[model samples]
Target: MSDNTTHPERCRCCGTMAVHRRLLDQDPGYARRRSRIEEHAFRAMRGTIVQRPGCTRIPVVVHVVYNTDEQNISREQIDSQIEILNEDFRKANADISTVPAPFAPVAADARLLFALAASDPDGNPTDGITRTRTDVSGFVDDDKVKADASGGKDAWPADEYLNIWVCPLSGGLLGYAQFPGGPAATDGVVVTYTGFGNMGTARAPFDLGRTTTHEIGHWLNLFHIWGDDGTGCSGSDFVDDTPNQGGANLGKPTFPKVSCDNGPDGDMFMNYMDYVDDDTMVMFTEGQVARMQACLDGPRSAIGEMVSCTPLHPKALPKDTPKEFTKEPIKDPPKERPKDNPKEFVKEPVKESVKEGPKDLIKDGIKDGGKELPKDNPKDFGKDPGLEPGKWKPLDPPPKQIFEVPTKQLVEGPVGGKQAFENPLPGGWGNQPVQPMQPMQPAQPLQPFVLATGQAPSGASLKPPVADGGGEQDQSQALLGEYAQLLAQYAQLYQQGMLDQQGMLAWQQAWAAYVQLGGR
Candidate 1:
């Protein structure tokens, strides 16, 4: 029987139903509160991304993780995505076929560019993109499949590389994206194979190849043009310059749309993050460029830490030929062979070539498919930190097996989010008012629970298990997660048992404090 009480709350990194349910159960108002926090966060971050003519160029490492050879999309496809970013940010989209002749002149060109790296995050040499091959395919929206290293997803140094996971999007959606600064914010891109590029599996017009450009915009902190209201026009996207939009547009919109009486530019339908076919969506407003810049300059400034701060690369290496052969000892040297001529001595072949050179095969990033992916739905998680009685389980001793995590790709075709999830306008996440004063109490120094990296034991889900043979495994690492889960379950049971209101508040407070302390 399906466990309705525990709805697949596992971390995408590790398939354990061990994730904290607090985030899922969070009141929708939390989004509004989070947006409020984002406002101040963006205002504070804008200062960092502004690059004047001679400003430092941010160096970035791109890790291209593929499930297999066919899913191994090429280097050029990666390059194309970068090219689109440079163009979109600089407001130099190749063409505005949708723009009426009247407004083509004011198109803005925000300045940005992405390149194959000339240096590694550590001031070493590199070619910007690294490729990994994983046996896993059929990417799902679920994060568990993609996180390979940690019992959860192991990330490339989040502060340094721009990790892009390339795999077949199992679901038809162009992959989903995470905004900066959330717990999972450190995660990388998951572009769908066919949904990714304009030239390859990517289709045309809609495939003008802007899906990634749009998602990355989300990565860098830009919102859907209509402010992602998900519905309703009363909400405002918060940007002063953008005209109020009634909701999200799905199929190609004819010009002069009269919703919310927006007009002239109509719906700003050409904006990135809209549902129009790729080619139809064209520009990002100066405000959007500013917002994105603010993001790069702000909360995500770590992305710049490894960028072109240095200027050198080891482009070549020495050959392995030995320079000078060591001479034989006196006794061995006495029998010199006759040469064609003393002056024209013949050379002897040496059995060993002692040469020093840079290792060429050292990959710039983790190789995918090097490990088997934990099965899609790990059947049983042995000792779930959370979940209910007899539902989840945990891995007693963690296995050190390397894994294949889910990589994301673009959501191709006209976006049908309208059907699956409504994005009606003006009042979504973007429009939510900024309540900047939400108090962030100073972090209380509390004892931290030990976290062991483990996977789901088989039963219902497919989490990987660490093997310690038969001896009793040390489980101190289960830490805050199990406790947090237990606490939640206890509260649920207490609520159902007619616990007094004060008792419930105490339970809720204790739970809130645990999460506040980053429990699990």
Candidate 2:
């Protein structure tokens, strides 16, 4: 085996971009699909579309193509890779706390959950793994490792499962992935055995299983943070939030390193899309999440629609299957008792002998001169002697008392001969008539609702009203119309399975702010 100690440079670490270019050149259909996918991503990003509610579960199939015993990794290693994917994609990795304060706000949980497929293409129970003994010493980025004829195992259906091929990679290459628009036969990702997982035969600096995470990011339609411009300032990863970078950052780079005039908070080298080591890269941004969600909504929607994480037997039907076909026939209940047969239902009463105790307690009390109580009578309670039956007499009114108004008394004061109270309070409160209460001026008609710079307080755009009318009612109507349009768009995306919980919440907050501003 070649020396595993030497790490490849940032540009050569992943071969996804190279594979992408080759596919664009060789297949015309792939190029067209790539264009359409990009257009969809662009729309999603521009609209800031919310993701669908709940976690998206994806079934995975790992194909292990090995040439030696060491290359044939253990089940624990494969499981470790799956767990790492779950953590990294969901932003549940422990290292995520190390993200800088500035970038942490945009760091997002993709809400993508991955599990080993429970059933194979033929609906047979499976462990979600395939091991093939390959004679080829090492596989290149050319994709021979994806087929059985080329000394590798063929992929499962790409539309139903995410195919992962783990083998020894040639030319110091770590891994590569075929993007969403590629042919299904060669779809999915490939990782080197040493860089595939965190345990057994896994090597340092690459053992945390982030290689598969990064490649799957590619599979989910994410571009590198550096924008793949080959050390130029002109490239764009198509994500708006990520800082523009001239080239990929390799190894462990300190925070806030400037490039392409992106200063202060410079290139996001710690991003999973960059070439940093496993322990270094830790996050995916909200913009990247939107892009991936667009892919799930469009090109790759089928794989996530249904997921089975445990083996499924052929005889067992889905939960939604008709009950009549899946369950046993109903049995008749026992007969009810006949109402006419009252004699048979009745039981014989038992005779009881009464015992006397504390005899004549009431009579003894009466003999001791206890007063007898009156008999119960409705007329005896709540009766007023002064009031006639069915008639109420009004009480006489009390005599009114007269109050003497105070007259101003003369006192020695600085103002000559001015009538003043003998004792004057501070602030000119002496001997003055009480001021009549002033009516509150009708609350100053609320100032016209205006959004400064057309932005909500949360920094989301309010998307100005369509009409230019100066009337408040017209402006409010326009704003309401715009809000309604946004709601309609949100509902459509949600129905199409394009929105995730985070995206849905963000859009909800935005429209809620609009409503507060009198949109509706």
Candidate 3:
């Protein structure tokens, strides 16, 4: 009908007609079927038919094609686009308040919401995101970006999933979309990576993820507000309520923009379907919402009817559960099981002794340099308390992987050229002259408990205790082992709600009384 030329300045969605032309060229009966659906939708839009009640949730799948690290956008960016869609479609955007007072009453919510598909076409679980690495530098509006053979991914079933392609678009084209009734493999929208979302590569003037909003509006069978005619007064988007505008508005225009002899409130440039900047566009007129409703009821009804089987995230467990009680993969980025490896499919049986061991106790203290000491007898730690290691294991304890409390430092420092003690009485001297304290270095990783034997100029030099000789060392080592057991027992008792502050102190006094009487 019109010139059918490309416009790279504002958008490149004019290629939808080109796709229609190709479909017409290849299929003999396709045009008839497409026209029938379109005619029915148009008739419904004009009140010859009624639209379906209630909102529809469209399942969306985002296909990310990248040639470089910068092009592979983050999940946050993808989520940002989805949020914008839901906000704009449901008339819930924060900026909905910005619509000019005259147009506020005319602005309508389309009653549509979008969600990343929970399951794929074949009923496989998915995050609704597919990432593909490509060698092709960039793409134009040629639709090559829709095919895996052409360095892009093939679309999922169009009747089931709304496939969105995010990649580097050349020629300053913000985005484009195929209207309903196009070929399934090439259906959906393509957005330039830079204009795809609100963050990352998303730049100024197009950074609000509104490019995706505009493109999805096209996907839902909406035409440009100015109707694609080049600056002429005689253009029709085929909707009644939208004021007839001479041409597309580019930037933010003030209220009461006059055009096409429509006075007072002329161009509805704030509409998403218009060519205005992302921040400038705000509302979709009620008539536009009706037209979109007709398309959903007629051509795209299959998509809305497909039931989503996405599972909800499970609620978190109670905070009292010990972390070691929960199972976890031993390796990061869990390695795939080997085909011939015996351990691949077979799970090691949990030893009964380890399973029934005292609640929060580690069976053995960690060895020096992170190695686990080999058991002299497999059942010694579990069966016999008499044979327990008399000395604290010389190694640094295992990295505090279990849920011990986070360590807090008392960090005494100088404030305003004077040292401020949190507890002035504990330092035992009032008005004592001390050197100005320097800023503390960052806390180091947790280390095993060491005895303070010598004082250095800056701080204490604590060394791991060594066993020298007979009864004294034995008694000291035995006391340390007893203390370790007390800690483990106390942790378990506390977790069971049997011990609070006073209860814990009473247990400690009883243990000390037993130790002093040599009752081990």
Candidate 4:
């Protein structure tokens, strides 16, 4: 029999709690570690323990285990997911505005940033993505996906890297995560390929990169908002701010959804821990943030203490090179050769030859053989045939301007000859005297400009005068208004998850038309 739980079609199901239970039964040390971790979290939840100030940057390594080409996702998809994580964790997501007003004040910025590791655990440069070809068709929550022996990629060191496995998942499971205090080898989160990111094979209702966000929340020690109680009102997620709820809120539940006598402001279905659709869930509560910080400060403290997202400089040395070479400085070669060496040079003859010089040797050769030597310059070398002695000629100068205005004419006005007035005005004002005209008295201050209630004022029309090309200008303005309206509608539909593929294509076509019509 399969260990996976069968869920209703289209329901959001996670295997984390079940896996946690199984681990508790299988490993006693894990239970002890869990107890310690929960104690730290409790202290953090109260005012006893304090979290480190400022943001914590964690390095991530994505292992892409694929049985087929589609299962092997692209680096772009991986990067998109990372970007989403950064935005969501920092409360920088654009859809945070969708969080209801009642819960908005408690929506916390986790102040955590996740980036793909730029260097592997071995200190080699990496893009932080690993691709493994596996014989297994699909993976489940059995931890087989965390080991190479079982046809999956083994993880990097858990203390230095957050290992995330993306592969084909069976049993309709979207994803699962190993919470803090888990065994090191099987640490980190596993997300199904289709539900991992917003692009590539990611499907709707689960797309928008929320599955990884939800799984990472679990990895950071957050519980499901519904407390994993399966409709029991008594269970708690251990966060005081979050309301006590019966079970996971599937699909998209409207605001003020009453459950477990939690009314007025009911279940915060929009929290990241809830099992809502990607578009529906948009926030993390302050209590959840505190719990995650506690995990970072306790069981996962080592990973957060240092950042390994930057590439290591001067990557690992070649395997064949001696390890001592890196530690010791190389000595200079010997200054002098041994006298008795077989390959010793005949330096005396070389010194004599250098003193004799090439000019002396050339002269002696010419005198002895009486052979005529070639002239220094080769005949006709670089000499243009047309430029020889009497054949030399110069080309005529370029033609002068067709007509030149006289200097006096240029200095004078356009009419030529002389200025209209000999005494031109000062400051280059042509011919008119510099007159100091009297300033007119300010127009009688219009009677306070106040009107009685509902009284009309007597005045000239305030409408602006139409200039030349006003009709075309008006038409263009109207088109601009229409373009703006279309853009606004496009953005609204996109944010609200109402636009389909065809609708997007139509919007693109309309945008192209607007650009062609000279709309900005």
Candidate 5:
């Protein structure tokens, strides 16, 4: 049987009947546990149990599941909700003045304050709002939305925190709550995102964040003021102060709304536990406060004990611990031998090899005043050629120009037989005055051919070739082909179980060769 209670448009909270159905269907022993809770509440109302000392601050975590942009409420909106909860729970709501005169004296401060947890369950600092993007448009009272697998976040430790889920609710449910003694995973309340916070996506009639206030009342073990019976006075909220009413009220009710033959005083329709618009609900009566206080002293005592400060991550290893290596060392060393015969290398004439040296290319490109990029065709600079030209949007106003200073600030020396720049520019670079243009140095002879990888030293540029008939395209294709062939050879060696450090070194050399051949 469907036990969900549907309310009119003004307020729709399916609290007691929904929870009763869920527990009965899911647990065999729910009835006995619920009866015990009722007995405890009854005793508290009759003054057998004392209210808790001072105010108990309950730490809260709000999970926001959004399908649209607006549903992801802002920080201010969350803060507003918390503010409203604090006001309503403590009986400090500004509208408490609107409560009927007869019911005003019995309105009690529940002495509860709600705070967003300062840290998450993992002990990391948090603002207490978790946002998740979901494809599900709305959630019924089925509780599927309480799981990460079901497009919502799993609740934090229910014993330590009040987990509130803010999302769009299906079946016109403004909100619902799991009364104490339910499964820990699904503990806490589900409030519609549109009715959650006063700001951002909050709709009319429900915009003041009273839905959370009303649902949280159930979480604290308070029953509906009108009782859950269908328009019958036999149903009781188990509180003496609240007048017997026919059923849940809608919109706003005038004073002296007599029901069930209660004449001089009428139904307390302004109570938070009743189904009314956000603006209509006003306060929780003293009898209701006693019932909720009994719950805190019984089922929910642990929530008051938890410290919401940031906790350290569970998997964080101690700094003093040493790491163990996973793989065994290679048995074979690299097979690439050092270049053969350094003495015989000087026998080759220097002039014949000058074009291969990178220094000459730089000198040739900059011999004129400054290099010019081809009219509108800026170099693609190692980017994918398959990129659609239509998608390339030019910068409206280009970034500020950076001055390229020549290599005069450097000292030249032979480093591992390759020309290396020495004495780099010092810090506080902008303080130094720009130097006059220096005369170009004579081109140096090339080093013995060895494949080089990685970037040129800072302040050096790879000069693109002068405009020739598709020479750059042909060179790029040839380099790419060679790179592919070298990769194929490496794969074959691996398959034959012949690949070792030597093969790895060969692959590195192939990459260097591609760079040298202007593959970019």
Candidate 6:
């Protein structure tokens, strides 16, 4: 305090002045915060992917809680933000007047869209907008907004709606978002108004308005365009076709400019997620969209659920107005899409019918022993029903969408690939090859059922059924005999008082008849 400016630095702990020691002795607040952030990241991976299909659209409520004057943004700007999201997620962000021809052809149209939610988490219709004034204003490290967990955003039925908080923070970091595991897992994305869009909250020129587009990209599980790898392209964001590049690009790159050893493609400097200055950014690739979708389907489905309301759509629903009436926008350089005549909000009601689903094997032919063996022929035991023995083994169905995402219903709601779960079987779901009953020889000679490595009593080799004899009745008789032994045991146990009493007498009579015909 003697002289603030020229005073030599000193360790607060011991007053030993040394430039290095003073710098090191500062509060250490930032480093501690970083450790906490990392620790929370570790907690996120223990999560689950969304597994159902055709879940309904999820609704979202944007609460713009502002304090400072700059944070004061208009609804139009917010609407533009939602529009950019729809185009980016849907992979339909076409309309290339903004991008150079060379890059236009390669632009990926993400398969997702956004809308002002039509209802609240309680299923009541809403304008999907809310405003609050908070002393909390300024830039933040994560997203520009969040559904506060404790009183801040209030505990939302997170699996049903996204709570976007537009507030200020003290960090210079761009924007940040949570990675799956869910709303409780991490705070929602946070962005600075100046960086939100070219339209709202931002100044012009710098506002070619893709900030929200970029931040929302992260919200959908996309990483930075440069892959955030210190090694760049070699580290990849795990996408299949995106060329790798070292670091992010700031102000736009002149055509044919090259950097990051990502030759040929040079740098994906134009990708929206890159750190490039506003006007320079142009597109998000299909590969990037897919990667994001994988996240949506896998660990982040809960967030995706915020898009749906019930067993149906989780969040962003489609326009009720016919496709022809809606405005088709993309993440084009700002002002490309007409923000003037915004489409009227359409609250499309979702319809679901639990039509008769296929009956499961367990519900049908299965018996006390799982399922009646096709006719105890020696050859039937453990053999694929005519399936090429080598070609078919147990396999999962191909992955499918957790939500019944109708590709054709692209007009209905947000079509995030993240919301899609791959059907886990080959040839997709319903095409599951029927698993024919295994061929186990007649009872007493075989083990009940077998595991992948389980063996049966020797002579596991089947004695094929005689072409003319040992009729179906004989086979049924043999199986019935086995059932009789089980029934007798049940009765004997009851007689010895080991079984529950009320039904004991009926069980005994059933056992007597069951054993009459060649009971084991």
Q: What are the models' TM-scores?
A: 0.49, 0.60, 0.56, 0.58, 0.57, 0.46
Highest lDDT scorer: 4
- lDDT against the true structure, each candidate: 0.46, 0.70, 0.66, 0.71, 0.66, 0.45
> What order do candidates take by TM-score, descending?
2, 4, 5, 3, 1, 6
Give the per-residue lDDT of model 1 (tens digit) for 11-37.
011111112123223334333333333
Error of 4 at 228 (Å): 1.3
lDDT of 6 by residue, 1-520 (tens): 0111231121001011111123224424322332222222211221111224433233566666677656767878887777656654444343334665566666765555456778777778788776656655453433224434332345355555565555554433334444333335333445545555447566543465566666666555555655554334434443434566765555557765566665664766778776666666667775575555555554445654433322212134455645645455433435743454333222222112122233444456465344445556555755645767433322321223223234433222122322111111124322223223234345423222211112221211211122255574665455454444444344333323444532443343333333333332
**How many steric clashes between backbone atoms does each model show?**
71, 4, 0, 0, 1, 80
Model 2 misses residue 57 by how many Å? 0.9
Q: In what order do the candidates fall by lDDT, top score first?
A: 4, 2, 5, 3, 1, 6
Clashing residue pairs, backbone N/CA/C < 3 A, model 4 = none
lDDT per residue (tens digit) for residues 1-520 in model 5: 1223453454555654666566766775554455456545644543334556777889999999888887788888889999888778777677888888888898878878889999989999998889999998988788877999998889999998999999887767788888877789999999988898788888888899998988888898877877676577756676668888888777777877888997878788899888777898889987788788899987888896423323221123444343333232232232322344544565565545765666876877776425455533455654555475434422221222111212221112122321111111125232333332222222421210000111111111112221346575654465456454554444434333455764554444443433444432
Candidate 6: give its CA RMSD in angstroms: 25.3
lDDT of 4 at 330: 44
User: What ranges in model 5 sit over 4 Å off?
Assistant: 1-8, 305-520
* Residue-wise C-alpha lDDT for candidate 4, range 1-520, written one tens digit per residue: 1222444346677888878877777886676566557656754564335578878899999999999999999998999899889888888787888888998989988888888998998899999999999999999999899999999999999998999999998887888999888899999999999898789988888888998999999999887887765777755566768988877888889998998999888999999898888999889988899899889988888895443323211113345467667544443323333434434446666666787877798988878655444443345454656465443322221223112333343234234344312212234333333232222223522211110011111121111123455765575556545554554454444434556765554455444434434544
Residue 51, model 2, lDDT: 47
Better of 4 and 5 by lDDT: 4
lDDT of 2 by residue, 313-376 (tens): 2222454577665454333222233443554545322112122323456557666544433443
In lDDT terms, how accurate is model 5?
Answer: 0.66
| Prediction 5 TM-score vs. true | 0.57
Better of 1 and 6 by TM-score: 1
